[model samples]
Target chain A: MDLLERFAKGDDAAFEALFRQFEREVYGWILRIVRDPAAAEDLTVETFWRIYKARARFDPQAPFGAWARRIATNLAIDHLRCRRSEQELPEQLGAPGAPNPALQREAREQIQRAFRRLPAKLQAAATLAFIEEKSYDEISDALGVSIGAVRLRMFRAVRILRKEFNRMGLKP
Target chain B: MTKLENHDDVRAILKKGFPRIRAADEEPRRDLWPAMLRKLDAHALRQRVPWYDWALLGALAGTLAFFPTSILLFMYHL
Candidate 1:
């Protein structure tokens, strides 16, 4: 039998197989939500640790993909909300590898300065819907908004982000 | 975005930049089965006691019930 079939029979190897296959996608999803690699890594680890802890309580017959993805989405959304409440988040993917630290730093600051001009709700909505690539259904579920609201919010968010990028001489 | 939407640029960014994706478990940690078995052991035992255990308790209650009225009558006569 395949590993999934074995997993249904309560096999450890089967669970490990699923974990190995999905962990990368899970981490990437978290990173897209948080935009901070460190936080994403931490939360990714926490997400899996939580699943392991809750494994026995899991009905093996349940839809594992949906169950695992939901846990990850919830953790990331909560993390982002808390961070937003504390202070503004910087708006760069990561530090550039170029030798000019000062110039790179200044450029990043300029981008952030522009990003902060967008409405806060738009910023939050963009990160989840665009960068995170969360489905409209998932975004609505996470944000407690209607699907129509999520769609409207995403449309407005991209327009704002595009304008912000354009001001920095970014074509896209 | 029409072109970008069809193509996953963010996905490309991730696939290019981040390569370290660890599995959701402690590798080489203590054997996992022992812990799973222990949890499974504790899980189902709390629901209902054995039939024999209830039978014994029921018998004890029945004996106590018979003696209670008899003792009350004896005390009244005394």
Candidate 2:
């Protein structure tokens, strides 16, 4: 049997080969969503463990990369949800073109706090759609939803953020 | 302003606030295969049946063997 067939049959060597092939892509995808190297590393491992456990259900003819990405995306969304409950927001390095360092830091912090407070689905969609400038189709695939659903999440995220930012007197 | 302009404003604000997007390291610092192996190992260990559970299962079998009527009781409980 070929690699995909072998992997579906629960062959360890085949699983390892597939893991090596997709490791960087999965890790990079998760890192982009989570934006934390340490958390991304842990989530990547979790994603693969899950993928292996569910191997019996995988169709050999299907694309492995997309399957791996969907698993990684769900794990990243869960991580974000857990972090949201804890209200943890990482500090961003000061960006150029901001005249006041202290004021800029405060604004960024406020934005981060509000952004993190969004529902995990909306947060993920917005992060991929807006900040990363990823295509809607790509975001939809990773999110395991239709393009319409992704657009809805994006709209909700943007509306919530705009309201929060306006209330805080941080206009665009 | 128009709807398009409103969206652009929000997008610009988001870009300004989330500057780390530009600086994020895309590549992982280390291979994660070892970690995946460890997790699989841990799960395999967890999947092993504990002695207590096996003992309980044995006791149930013995009870059912001795009193076939108990099979009805078990089915009822289930």
Candidate 3:
């Protein structure tokens, strides 16, 4: 039988093999959404654990990478939902090639604060669409939504963020 | 002004506000198999029934054995 089929039947070796193959992709995807390496690592492990447990429901014929990404996205969204709105994002996540480090850092902090205030779903959509520059199709696939839904989410996210930034009087 | 107005301005603000961090695209530093194993082991440990629960089950079974009529009550409660 194939690796997915074996995994579905509770084959430890097959599970480990799949984990070895997909761990990086899964972890990288989660890291992009959560933007915290440590938390991403933990969530990566959690994602695989969930995959293994829910193997019975998996269809062997389906593409594993997309399935794994979907699970990773859900876990990242959950992490976002659970995070305190006021908690500062990790300082290590500095903007690339900022002309002024101090001012850029302050701007990034304010933006992140506003970004985090968004509903978790909108945050995920906006992150994937604009920040990461992922395609609407890929974002929709990962988010388990239609392309139209992704567009709507992006619109809502931008609108809310604009309102929040205007209120904060912090123009980026 | 309405929420939908200034659409391009707000989109630009968001993009500028949240620039992509360089690290987001990189793969994890270390192999995560061992961590996955540890999480699996922890979940397994948690799934085991404690002695108190077994003792409670035994007491219920023993009581049911003494008074079979109570089986109906137990089923009803369940």
Candidate 4:
């Protein structure tokens, strides 16, 4: 609580502690949305920068985690929207600096092939929950869906990921 | 014999059948402190639109648009 107060008051140490606590989670959450690590990192930094600029205005009664997630969510969505009109995949996320060819080929063949086979909703939901580590509530906010809907999507996604993992002899 | 209580085949199958899910990789940053600090700052800065605000706006708009019309064509008096 004291930490929250300090953070509310612009104490760097308090802010540092808070960042350490949620950095990966936030980054993962955004990455789940964008599906690109490099992009996610950039967005993560941007999200935190926005947080720093907006901290004083936060309501103490509100859930801080959800609040921060909202920022990252909007930013990630804005990013996706910006990219929507672009036909080709961007250069950075292009096929250039990926894994070694053989491994990449296998991984891509296995992952992308299976991914494409699933419904769009399932793919999005699974990646967000499993890969991103977002809580149900956070996913609901990010996706702008109800809690029940998020859980249902997550349940189906888990099944798909488990099935895929099993096919690859990977432990779920 | 209770189904697979002491069945080696079942145990082996169970262990072998489970799927492996690899975790996503973390970012290159050494510490999350900076990011978290930023998250708090960002959270505080939300331009939140509360439900009541919307409700009030809707009500206000309704009031402006509404006109009182209390004329009964025929009122039956007993």
Candidate 5:
């Protein structure tokens, strides 16, 4: 049987192997979405816990990475939604320059600010498309939306981000 | 400009700006294995059924007792 099947049968070793394989990727993906290292860790653990609990329903034929990513993405999106009331966008972007660590961090923060301004679904779509570099089909599966919807969300997200960046006097 | 023209402008800007955002591949700041293990252990413990579920069960039992013939009908449908 496959790893998922073994896990479904309560094989602890199989579960451990799966966790070790996907832990970093899952955690990174969550961190990108939530922009909180602490919350990302908690959500990563919760994703794995969910996977373990729902192992019996897992289709062995499906790609494990995609399935795990979908779970993590959904959890991250839900977390973002819950914390929506408290989120704030930074007012300015640093001037453009050669790639330095400080410049990179500033750009990242600005991107995050622009990102936070989007609706949760739009954020998910844009993140999957731009940050995760996922294809439309992959993003559709991850976000549980049609490809058309994903495209629309991406479009809207970009539009909003551009407008916000313009207001901040940042040439996007 | 038309909406389509605005959309094109936004797309152009996004193409330029997106790459400026850093790609993160960092490990979690702290180890999470112990916490996860604790969560797993907690999950292994028996879960308490909610009061509403218990009430629903009692109602079903009472209904079955009052109309035992319904059991035969349910079995037939199954």
Candidate 6:
């Protein structure tokens, strides 16, 4: 039986298998959008839980990967909205005694900080387009926006990120 | 004078500025399944109504019983 068929039949093993398959991509997509490991992890688990809860609603004809990603992306967007209202930012990226090489850590942190500074929609667009390397059509479908809007958001996000990078004295 | 446009400069800068951190290979610092289980339990718990809400419901029923005309008024407003 297919994964969704097995899932709908209440097969725990199939569910676990599906989780293992999509977990990394879902987590990475959420992380790129939220820029917080903790929040991303929480959202990743929540996404899986949601998927499990809504298994019966899963359309067998639709691609499971896209469906799972849409769920993850929506949760990430909701988390960002809630965090923005609370004025909570991610913890400073390069805290003291970090594990990664100093230069790499700093670069990552800088990029994350710049990403966080963007408006939530722009951040989502940039994360999907550049970080996830999703095509515009895929992004539009995942984000539930028109393709034109996706292009506009991506353009605006790139412009803003470029400006922010230049201001930080980061050169190509 | 208008500043000279540098489209290629910005494009190059963006290409370099994109972070190379790959989320695909990176493992979360902590296992999240336990927390997920806790959340599931919490959700299940939330489906059960509390006694206070039951009491309030009882009170509403009592009020409605004592005042039958209020039902029409409530229905009208709704």
Top TM-score model: 2
Q: Against the true structure, what is each candidate's TM-score?
A: 0.46, 0.80, 0.77, 0.46, 0.69, 0.64
Return the clash pairs for model 5, or none: none
The residue-by-residue lDDT of candidate 1 on A1-172, one tens digit each, is 8665566566767767777777666666666556666676667666766676677677766667666776877788677656654334344433333468775565555544444454555555566655445577776765557878876776765566564454444332
Where does candidate 4 stray beyond 4 Å? Answer: A85-138, A144-172, B1-21, B27-78
DockQ per model, Cα:
0.04, 0.35, 0.30, 0.07, 0.18, 0.16
lDDT of 4 at A55: 82
Maximum-lDDT candidate: 2
lDDT of 5 by residue, A16-87 (tens): 889988998889878767767788999999999999888888887788888998999899999988765445
Comparing candidate 1 with candidate 5, which one achieves the higher lDDT?
A: 5
- The model with the greater lDDT, 2 or 4, is 2
Docking level of model 6: incorrect
Instruction: Give each model's clash number.
Output: 0, 0, 0, 14, 0, 0
Return the DockQ of model 3: 0.30
Docking class of 5: incorrect
Stretches of candidate 1 off by over 4 Å are A1-11, A56-63, A85-107, A110-124, A132-146, A152-172, B1-78
Q: What is the full ranking by lDDT, best candidate first?
A: 2, 3, 5, 6, 4, 1
| Poorest stretch of ten by lDDT in candidate 5 chain B | B1-10
* Angstrom error at residue A110, model 2: 1.6
Summing lDDT over every window of 10 consecutive residues in candidate 4 chain B, give the lowest-scoring window. Answer: B69-78
lDDT of 3 by residue, A24-121 (tens): 88888888888888999999999999998899999999999999999999999999999839653433333423688886767767677879889999
Q: How high a TM-score does candidate 3 get? A: 0.77
Number of the candidate with higher TM-score, 1 or 5: 5
* iRMSD in angstroms, per model: 8.0, 3.3, 4.4, 10.1, 5.3, 6.6
Best-first order by DockQ: 2, 3, 5, 6, 4, 1
